[model samples]
Target chain A: MVFSKEVKSVRTQTWIGIMSVASLVAIAGIFLKVAMSTQPREENYENITKPGYAIRRKYFWALLIVSVVCLVISVISFPYPAIMEAKITGEPVVVKATGFQFGWELDKDVLPVGKPVRFDVTAKDVNHGFGIYYHGKDGSLKKGIFVAQTQAMPDYINKLYVTFKDPGVYRIWCLEYCGAAHHIMTYEFRVE
Target chain B: MDVADRSMYERRVSGIALGYGAITLVLFGVTVFFGVIMRTSQGEFISVRPDVLYEFMTLHSIGAGGSLMAGVMAVMWYTLRKHLDMSMNIMQVVFGIIGAAVVTIVAVTLLGYYGTGWTFLYPLPFKSAGAWYDFAPGMWLLALMCVIFAFAMSWIDVIRAASKKYGFSNAMGWTLISGTAKPENVPPPVVLISTVTAACGLLSLVAGFIVVSLMLIHWANPSYYLDYLFIKNLIYYFGHIVMNMIMYMCAAIVYELMPIYANRPWKSNKIVAISWNSAFVAVTLAYWHHLLQDFPQPLIFQFLGVFGSYMAAFPATVVTITGTLILIYKSGMKWKVAPLYMYLGLMGWAIGGFWAVMDAGFNQAVHNTMYVPSHFHTYLLVGAAFIFVGGLYHITEELGGCRDTFEDKLGLWTWFVGGYGFVLWFMISGVLGTPRRYAVQMPGTEIYSTAAVYFAWTVVFGLLIAIARYLTRLQSVKPLRG
Candidate 1:
C-alpha cells in the first residue's frame, strides 16, 4: 500500500505552530504599542484600578473557558489503552518489546497493515524510550521524523498502540537518554 | 536602629548582593559557553567525544539552573532586606556553599567524567556501562545536595523573617482574602511572592532530600532495590518545583522593580493574593506533565497534568502580564536598559508560557523532543534571565551609580534578537520530531542544529559586550547610604 506521508499528527503539529505564532504576534503588537506611546502624562490610580479589575474579571473567565474546552478535547483524544481499544474494529495484535543498553528487541518483526497493534515495552536495565519512526517507500529511517513513543523502564511494561496504514519498514529509536551510545539504540521492523 | 547602624546594614547587604550577582554572572558565562559547544558539536561544527559531550550536558543543566537560581535569589534577598529583617550571616553561608558546590561539580564532571545528564534518572548512574568512575555519581549527588541545602537555608531565613514580621498568613496575603488587611499589615507583592516561593521551595527541598537519600542508600548497597517509577516521580517533582520557584523569584524581582520604572505602586490586592495562593498548589501538581509519557502511570494524574499546567498560566497571564501592560501604557516610562529588558522579559514570559501550555495539552506530539527545551529556553533565557538581568541593572544603577551607555543598549538589542533566533530553530526542530539530549544529531536534524549555532554565538557576543560594560562601571562604584 502507498500511503500519504502527511499524517493527521503532522497536520496537528502544523496547527500548533500556526496558533502559537498567531498568539505571539498579537502579544508582541500589544507590547510594542504600549512601548511606543511614551507621552508624559499622569493618571489617577483609582480610575485605572476600577477598569483594570473589570477587564481582569472578564479575561480570567475567557482563559478559564478556553482552558476547559482544550482540556476536554485533549482528554477525549488521549492515547490510553481503553481509548485505543475503542478505536479499533477487531482484536489488536500484541507485540512484546524489550530494550537493553543500546538496542531494542521486538518479539514480532512483521505486523499486519491496517490493523491495530499493541506494543508492550519494557527495559532490562535503566530507562529507555520506545519511539517508532515511519520509513515510507525509501525503507530507511530518517532522523527526527518520529510517529509515536512511550517510556520503557525496568520492572514495568508500557503499552503503546498504533495502526500502520502503509506496508513499509518502521524504525524504533530510543527517545530517553540511556547512557552511552544512546543514539545508536535503533531497531527496525516491517508491516505487510 | 540609628541612622549610622542602618547605613552600615544597607551597605553590607549591597555588597553581598553584588557578590552573588558577580558569581552568578560568571556561572552564566561558563554555562552558556558550554551550551554553545554542545549545540555546535551537535551541528558537526566541532567534534566532541560522546562522553565529553554528555559531561558538558550534565554541567550545562546544573550550571544554568544554578546561575538563574542564584541571580534571582540575590535580587529577592536584596529587595526583601528593606522590608524584612533577614540575616546576612545566612546569605554569606549560602554564598560559601554555592561556591564550594560549583567547584565540586566541575571536578566531578571534568575529572570523573560523570555524564549521567542532570536528572541521573534512577539506575542510569549505577549503570554507566564503564563510562565513568565508580565514585563520580555519589560525589555528584552530594554536591547537588549541598546546593539544595544552601537554597533551603536561604528559604528558611526568608520564611522565618517574614513570619516574624507579618505572620505567615499576612505574608502570604491571606489577610487580603478576608478583607481584613490594614495599610501596615499587608505585605508588598515582592514579600508575598517570595514567601510563597520559599514555602514551596522548602517543600520541594524536602522531596529532593528524600529522593537523594534513597539514591544514596541504593548506591551504597546493591541488595537494596528501588522502584523506578516512584523515584522518577519524586525526581520530577523536586526538579520541576525548584525551576518554577526560580521563575517565581524572578517575578518577585519584577513585582518590586517594574513599579519603580513605571512610577506606580503595585500593591497587594485580593485578586493578586488569590492568584499567587492558587499558584502555590498548582505549581506542585503541574509536575505530572513531565511524566505524561510514562504510560503505566495513572490516567487521572495525566489529566491533572494538563489541568495543572493550564492553571499555572492563569496567575501569570491574568495578573502579572496584564498588570505590567497597564502600568506601562502611556505612563511615560523610560526605556532604559533595566526596564527595557524587563518589558521584553514579560513579553517572553507570556509567549513562552503560551507554548508551554500548548505543549502540556499536546504532550504526546512534542514530549522529550527539542520542543521541550525550546519552550523552556524561551521562558528561562528570554523570560527569567532577562528579568534577572534587568533587576541587576536596576540595582547597580541605584546603588553603585552605574549608568547605561550606548554599548549597553547595543548589547541588549543584540541579545534580544539573537536569543529569539536561537530558540526559534529549536522549536522548529521539535516540530520536525527531533529528540532532545542527543549527543549527535540524527542526520536531517543536524541542519537545524547548525543554524542554531550561529544564533548562539550572536548571543554570546552580546553577553560579552554587556559584561564588559558592567565590569567597567564597577570600578566607579560608591555605595548609596539609606
Candidate 2:
C-alpha cells in the first residue's frame, strides 16, 4: 500500500511538472517567434490595428469567461465554508491550538479517525503558521507535504478543518517564519 | 517647452537616471548573492546557523525590494520628464533618503541581527524570541519610515506636476474615458500609467506609514495594544501595492520605449484609458489575495481577492502585451538588446501572472509555500528586472551613444537561461509542497535546493558579465549633443 501511494504521488508530480513546462515552452515560443520577426517597411497601420483589435476583443472575452469559470469552481472547493459550518453546528471535535515562537500547544493530543477535527488556531506571542504534516510510524514528518494550514495570528482565531481517514501519527509545523528557531517549531499528535 | 530647454532637461534627468541605474544594478547583484547564500544554506552546502540564515533572508528581501523600487522610480521619473516638468530637486531628495535607508537596513539586519521577515508583521518584530537586539526592530522601522516618506514625496511631486501640465483628470485618462477630450488630446500611455501608479502608490505609502508608525509606537509603549488582524491587513496592503507598483512603473517604461523601437504610436485610446483606470482599482483590491490564508479575514474580502487578482491581469494582457506584440509585428524593428529584453520581459510578466493568478485562487494549496516565491521571482526577477535593465540599456544607447557588443548579447542569453532555470526549480519545489523561508529543509526537499544553487551561480555569472559590459560602455560614453 505504501509503495502504491508513493507511485501515485510521483505520477502526480511528474504530470504537473510536464504540463507546466509545456505551457511555458509554448508561451515562450510564441513570443520568441514574434521577437525574431522583422517588420515590413510598407506595412499599413490600419491593417494591423483593425485585425489586432478584433483578435483582442475575442481574447478578452475568452479570458473573462475562463477566469470566471475558474473562480466559481475554486470558490466551490474552498475549505472555509465547511470549516465555518462545522464551527456553527459543533459537529467536529474542537482542538485549541496556540502557537508560540518555537512551539505549538494543542489542547488535545489525540483525535478520532474518519471524523472532522476543527483546529481553532491562534498565536500566543506573534504570528505563526498552523501547518499539519503527515507523519510516518518512525516518528518523522512524511516528505514535507502539508496536510492543511492557516495563519495563527496573535489575538485571532483561524479555524482550520481536517478529516483523517486512516489512523496514524501526525505532526504540526509552523509554516510561517516566526523566529530563528522556526524550523524546530513542531508538535506531534495521534489520530486513532 | 523650447527645444533647447527640453534637451537640457533630458540630459539632466538621463544623467541622474544613469547614476541611479548603476547603483541599483550593484544593489541587485548584492541581493542575488544573498539569495544564493540562503539557498546554499538550505542545501546544506554551507553550514550557517538558523539565525544567520534568517538574517540573510531579511537582508535579501530588503535589498531586492529597495533596489527595484528605487531603480523603477528613476526610470519613471526619466520617462515622465519628456512630457511634464517634474522637479529634479525632489528626485535628488528621494535618492538621498533611499541611500540612507539602504545603509540603515544593512546595519540593522547584519549587525543587529534583525531576523524578522521584510513583511515585519506586527508583534513579531517586537517579540523576536531573543534572536535580535531590542533596538533592531525600532531602527528597522525608522529606516522603513524614511523609505516610505521618500516614495510618498516622489508620488506627490509626480501628481502635482502632472496635474499642472495636463489636468489631473486628463493625466489619469479619465477625460479620454469619459469622451470629454478628443483622442488626439489624450495623454501618452506613459503619462496615463504613471498617474494611476502614483495615485495608488501614494495611497499604499500612506498605509505603510500608518502601519510602521503603529509598530514604532508599540515598540516604545508595550502597554499599547493593537489588532493583529488589522495590522496584518495593513502590512499586506502596503507591501502588495508597492510590489505591484514596481511592475506598473515598468509598464510605463515599456509603453514609452516600445513605440520608439517599433516606430509606431502606442497611443491612449478610450479602451487603453479604461483598462488603466480599471487597473488602478484592481491592483488596490488585489492585496486581499495576500491575506487569503488568514481565515479570520472577511469572506467578502477573500472573494474580492480572487476577483481582483483575475481583473489585475486584464489591462496587461488586453492592452499592453497585445499592443506591444502588434506594434512590433510587422514594423521591421531591429532586434537590439533593448527591444529583446523588453520583449522577453513582457513575456515573463505574462507567464508569471498566470502562475500568480493560480496561486491566488488556490491559496489553500500553496499559501506560504515555495510557490509564492516561485511566482513572485518569476515576475520580479525575470519580469521587472528585465524591463528595468532594458530601459537602462535604451537610455544608455540613446543619450550616451553606448552600443551593444557580442559579449553583451551572450551575457543576456546566459542570464535568461540561468534565471529561468533558477525559478523553475523554485516552481517545481512549490508544486511538491515545500514551504518557503525554512533554514533547514524537510527531509526530501533539500535536493531541489541543492540543484537550484548551481542555477543561482549561473545567474550571478551572467549578471557579472552584463555589469562588466555596462561599465565598459559607461567609461566610453560621451555627453549628449542636441
Candidate 3:
C-alpha cells in the first residue's frame, strides 16, 4: 500500500547517492571539455561568410564564458537551461507581397540559359517553407527545395539561396502551413 | 525449462512474443539512440559524420515504425484473447501470428531498402528502396487481414459478454448508465465504446490496405497521372486511427479497474450510456489532426480535426481524474503495488493527455517542434504501455494468484521512476532542438551538450528499468487451475 511506513534502506540510499555523484562528475567533466575546446571567436566559424560574423564571434565567446561561470554557481541538474545563441549575422531583405502573390525584382530577369539565379526568401508573420517549381524539359513543375527547412525568423525575413540552371518560368511558393490563403501565396520569374 | 505446466506453456508463448517485441523495440530504440547522438553532434562538439547520421536517420524512422506496428499488434493479440469470454478462433489467431511473422521477416530481410519513413510516400519508396522498398503493399495487406481477424475475435468476445450480462435489446435500449461500476462489472458503456473504437480501427485498416495497394500499383509502373496526394490522404486516415485504438484499449482498462480501487460499484446506468455515446462520436471524428502537419489539408478539415482532438482528450481526462479523486478520498485506501500501478498508470495517461492537448493547441509554440515527439512518446510509452502493464499485472495477480515479493516491489519502483524520468529527459532533449529523425543534433547549437547528457541518461535508465522488470516477471508461480 502507498501509505505503508516503509522507508528506503540506508545502504540503498547511499548507493544511489554515490551513483548520482559519479554521474554529476562525469557531466561536469564533459561540460568543461566542451567549453575549453571552442574559444569565443572560433565558435562562429559557420557564419564566417555573413556580414559582421567575425566581430560577433568575439563577443559570443565572452558571453559564453560568463554564462558558464554563472551555470557553475547556480548548479542545477541541467547545464544552461536557456538557449545559448551561437552568434549569427545577416541583414533582413524585405520583399513586397501583392494579394496571394509574392514578387522580387532583381534588375532584369533574363540571364544565360544555363545560368543560376539564387533568390533570398523570407516570410513576414509565421514560418514559411519556400519551394521553387521549375519546369523540366517535359514541362512538369520540377520540384525541389528552394529552402527545404522552415527557417524561423521573428520579423518575417528569411534568406533562401536557390540556383536556377535551366531557362523557363520558375514559380516560388511557401510550403510551410502559414494561415488561410497559403496555397495562393505564389510568385513567378523567368530565366532566359 | 522444468516440466511445463499451463502457466509455463503460457509463459513460453508470452516469452517468445515478449522477446520478439523487445528486440523490435530495442532495435527501434537503438536507431533513435544513434539518431540522438548524431543530431547532437552536428552543431555541438559531438557532430558525427553526416553520411553516418543519414544512414541511421533513414533506418530509425521507418524501422521504429515497423517495430511499433508489430509490437502493438502482438500485444493486442494477447490482450484481446484474454478479454474475450470464449476462447478465440485458433485459425484466426494463427493467421494473425503468421501474418505478423511474414511482415517482420519481409521487413528485416529488406532492411537495406526500408527508408522513406513508415508513410512510405509514393515516389520516395520507389526512389529510395526501388523494388525492395516496394514490399510495403505486402506489409499493409497483412495489416488489413490481421485487423479483420483481430476485430472479429474482439467483436465476438464483446457481443458475447454484453449479451450474457445484459440482454442485447436492453443493453441498447437503456439511454444511459449512471454511477461507477465494480471491477468485474462489464458496463454497457465500456463495452460499447471499445467496440466502436475497434470498428473505427477496422475501417482505418481497410482504408490503409486499399491505399497501399494503389501505391504499389503506381510503384510497379511509374505513371505520370498517379495521385500520390490521394494515397497519402488515405494512409493518414488509417494511420491516425490506430493510435486512438491503442488509447481506447487503455481507456477500457481504466474504466474496468478504477472501481476496484474506489470500492464504488456501478450505480447510475444513464451516465454510462452517455459516456459511451460521447466516446463513439468523439473517436470517429478525431482522425483529422494527423493531417495538420505539412500536408495541404483544407482549413475546414483542420478546424474539425483540432475540435475532435480536444474533444477526444476531454472525456478521458474527466474519467481518469474523477476516478483518481474517488480512489483518493472516497475509499479508505490500501497502497499496495497493484493499486500503485493503477494510480501511476492513471497519472501516466493523464500526463500524456495533458501534453497531447497542449501540443495540439496551435497557440503553444513548443507544440510545433520535436517537443511534440516528447508528448507522444510520453503518451504511447507511458500512458498506453503503463496501463497495459498494470492490466497484465492484475491478471498475473488475481488470475494467476502471484503475490508481489520485495524484489517485485523494487521492479515496480524502478519501472515507475525510471520510465517517467527517461521520458522527461527525452522531452528535454527534444526541446533542445534535437531533431527527431537525425542521428545527431545539429552541431554548434546551444542545446547540444544538455541534449546529449539527457539522452545518455535516458538510455541508461531505460536499460536498467527494462532489465529489472524483465527479471521480476521471470519469477513465476503456479498456474490458474480450471
Each prediction's whole-model lDDT (CA): 0.86, 0.84, 0.46
Scored against the true structure, residue B387 in model 2 reaches a CA lDDT of 89
**Per-model DockQ against the true two-chain complex:** 0.71, 0.60, 0.02
Candidate 3 accuracy as TM-score: 0.60
lDDT of 2 by residue, A34-111 (tens): 777655653687887788789889999998998899789667656684445744434889999999989999999989
Q: Who is ahead in DockQ, 1 or 2?
A: 1
Q: What TM-score is obtained by chain A of candidate 1? A: 0.88
lDDT of 3 by residue, B166-247 (tens): 5443343233343343434444344554555555566776776677667656656667445544555676676766666666
Candidate 2 has an fnat equal to 0.70
Query: Regarding DockQ, does 1 or 3 come out ahead?
Result: 1
Model 1 TM-score? 0.97
Candidate ranking under DockQ, highest first, comes to 1, 2, 3
Give lDDT tens digits, candidate 2, residues B75-183: 8888888888889989999999999999999999999999987889888898987899999999999999999999999999889988887889998988988889865
For the predicted complex of model 2, DockQ is 0.60
TM-score of each: 0.97, 0.95, 0.60
Q: Best-fitting candidate, measured by DockQ? A: 1
DockQ score of the complex predicted as candidate 3:
0.02
Show the lowest summed lDDT stretch of 10 residues, model 2 chain A.
Answer: A1-10
